[model samples]
Target: MSRFPILPRHQSGFAYIAAVIFLVVIAGIAVVLLRLTETQQSTVNQALLASRASLAARGGIEWVFNNPVQRCSQAPLSTSNAAPAGAVNHLTDFRAESGFLVSVSCSFRAYNEGEAIDASGNSSPVVKRIYRIDAVACNGTANTCPDTGSVPRADYVERAQVATICLLTDGAPCV
Candidate 1:
């Protein structure tokens, strides 16, 4: 109030402007961080689903190898997938947490005694059986189609595995 009189126009709101700018930068950084997190989460989810599908497919192949006699069973009834009286050769499904579906099929083909026989004329009786296994695993939750006994949709991830097994060795020369 003495001789020095400060004018209102001399005061500047530079501090307020700086503060607003800082806040805006912080908000942008937060948004970017959130986006990155979401992307990472999605990637992890896809990887886990793929692993589960692979395991499901592998399980089917293992089952066929473990049960060689079942592969020689009679053909399934045309009306139903149930085993023919005593044999058990059919498609089966397995899952870990219920969202995965693994379709497994076991089939067999017989080769002549000259197929893989050794040099001797006698063929080993133990080597009489051979079987093949095919397994396909996919995510059932992504399927929108009903169970019409057809193939799964293309959108769902799928894994396939195959294995051919021979039971024993033969002595007859195979040409």
Candidate 2:
């Protein structure tokens, strides 16, 4: 009765189903790209924070080294014990940025090396003082070095630096 043979109608709405599948795949790829971008941004931020922390720690070390007389005087050698206790100094928010804090620890030891003849032809003991310094910088609380808060944060950063210096004392107090 039909002029033209009717094709099978089982393929009805095939285009709609195909379109939905394509949309879902495209959305999934978009989500993946967004997530990857976010992760990369986080890594870059962490690296920058780390660099800031390192520079802050170096600044603390230099500060202590420059003011040896005052700092060494504060760290008195202990006679009671063979090993003296070191002195710890804190410079809260010392860096240009408000997020950074620096803490410097110093220890001093005096020892007599070999005998030396002075210009007056008098023999004198050569006294040498050794200074051990450590500087720690952190983006934690304004008053502390390491972040000791109960809640741990992914953005927290910290760096530590150390140096040792030896000075010859000519019968005077070693700074």
Candidate 3:
């Protein structure tokens, strides 16, 4: 029998296959990372919008408080005599400054002003006036509710309300 010499096989094909597999894995990882980044960015944007909306609401409240003559009643009285009773009363008196939008509503209700309890187990009549302000900011071009985190369709409303309390005293600050 004649001994045959063994020849080494070329590994170029193996190298190519390994490189392709590596590239595929890298691509998959990159895609996953991109998706994660997108999600994070959306969340951050929503949060920012919400914060701005809240500030706008607060601004409305401040406006109402500052302009008591227009936003609130001259005298603290019961809700029955007022135009509208309860918290839902329409204020319809507010002004929006530049870069802000505001709407204000007010109503009067009789509440005990004194902290002490009377002998009849009832508190003294304070007759406080409550004002409600609904304000919103058109931040950017997005028209979606920040809380829901979804696209808003027709008839979708994105407004925030802030209620303020004021005493019956002269020049009393809103609580």
Candidate 4:
């Protein structure tokens, strides 16, 4: 007797239920997309940090080469107690500029590769000094590189670079 016809009992709230389900599915998709975007952003940020660390490490190596005091001097095996003064100062400067800690180590090896003629037309032993230089850059709370003291951070980044340099001297070792 009413103006509208009565719907079946089982299908009374069909539209409402369907709308709810659709909303839930849409929300799930949105959440997944948001998570994906966040993950991509995180990856990009990590890449940037890694690039900065690499640049810092390379800069440290260049500093070692350019600095007269640390050029061929033997680096201490452990930086816990005493690192080269020049290296430490350079690291400090870089930290201020790029918020990264850089540590540099170097070792020298000498080899005699037969003999060579000098400008004076005198033959002398060709002393080859091979310098192995290593630089480690990290964003950590530890005082030195390799960040052993601090807890693992999701945003932490580190980079290492090695450079080998050979210098030929006239029967002289690289001191």
Candidate 5:
């Protein structure tokens, strides 16, 4: 009567209700996208951690090979308390500079096991050894030998590598 026609009460709040519904839908979408992004970031971080652990394991095995003590079978590995000096089998642990722990184990076997006799068919006590080396590294804790592949915690990441190392006393001259 004064300036505009009267509107129904239900139609009065139509625009406000529509705007609220639109905002809720947008918020839901945003939350979903954020969660996806967070999940992706977590995956990437885990991958990077696993890669670091792998590098740490590789470095540990290399360190074992390059170590004169392990190569010459001179002393008990620093990580082992049960292994005797110059023992055939040994275990070692190395902590990397990047805050990771690496564990290495070597299993020794006689390369000439059944046929240790020489060309003259004379048995001689040779100083040759066959070493099978295995290494594992982790950010939190390392897996022991013969593990069942269970995750200890949500944040722990680990990697393992193995190699066949053959050390002969006659090949490399030890000083």
Candidate 6:
């Protein structure tokens, strides 16, 4: 019996299938990597926005400290209407060199002490003024003033709330 010449079975099709599978896996991995990179970039951007907001809030507090008369005046900071208690009032909007925006608000409350005997048996009633200031900074836009029931944000926007009580001791300390 004559044996047929040895012939190799066709295996070229298997190579193509293996290559396709490998390429699919590589594409999946690439997508995952791209998503991770995007998330990291977003987080960094938010952090930067927060930092700018905080700086703006601090600037508002300092402005109040510098202008004692304006802080105690009945005239509101940014409006002609009288400032009401438990209300937020706008103060200023400043632009930083880096293009960040800062906004400020101030609220004032007056407290009066009952007449009492002093160290020398003198009776007097002391009146004190307390100023609650709120400042906010935003990276790309301005935010509304914070209210009593509002929650504050940081970074893209930052809020700073401060309550300072100044005794109206003949207006010496306040001035």
Of 2 and 6, the candidate ranking higher by TM-score: 2
Show model 6 residue runs off by greater than 4 Å: 1-10, 72-93, 114-122, 140-162, 171-175
Write down the TM-score of every candidate: 0.60, 0.80, 0.59, 0.76, 0.65, 0.65
lDDT tens per residue, model 5, 17-99: 99999999999999999999999999998899888888888886787688534553554433222322332222334443666
lDDT tens per residue, model 1, 79-111 = 222333333222433644546566666665444
Alpha-carbon local distance difference test for all models: 0.58, 0.75, 0.52, 0.74, 0.62, 0.59
Model 3 per-residue lDDT tens digits across residues 44-129? 86676566656766665676667754555554344333544323222222222333234445554434455545799986444455
lDDT for model 2 comes to 0.75
- Residue runs of model 1 more than 4 Å from their true location after superposition: 1-8, 72-93, 96-98, 113-130, 141-156, 168-175
RMSD of 4: 6.6
Residue-pair clashes per prediction, in order, are: 3, 0, 1, 0, 0, 3
Pairs that collide, model 6: 49-155, 50-155, 50-156
Which has the higher lDDT value, candidate number 2 or candidate number 3? 2
lDDT of 4 by residue, 45-98 (tens): 999999999999999889877742346454522212232333333376778899
- lDDT at 52 for candidate 4? 99
Alpha carbon lDDT of residue 68, candidate 5?
A: 36
Candidate 1 — worst ten consecutive residues by lDDT sum? 76-85
Report how far residue 59 has shifted in candidate 1, in Å. Answer: 1.0
Candidate 5: residue 81 lDDT (0-100): 28
Clashing pairs in 5: none
Model 3 scores a C-alpha lDDT of 0.52
93 in model 6: Cα distance from truth in Å? 6.7
Model 5 residue runs over 4 Å out of place are 1-10, 68-72, 75-96, 113-128, 141-152, 172-175
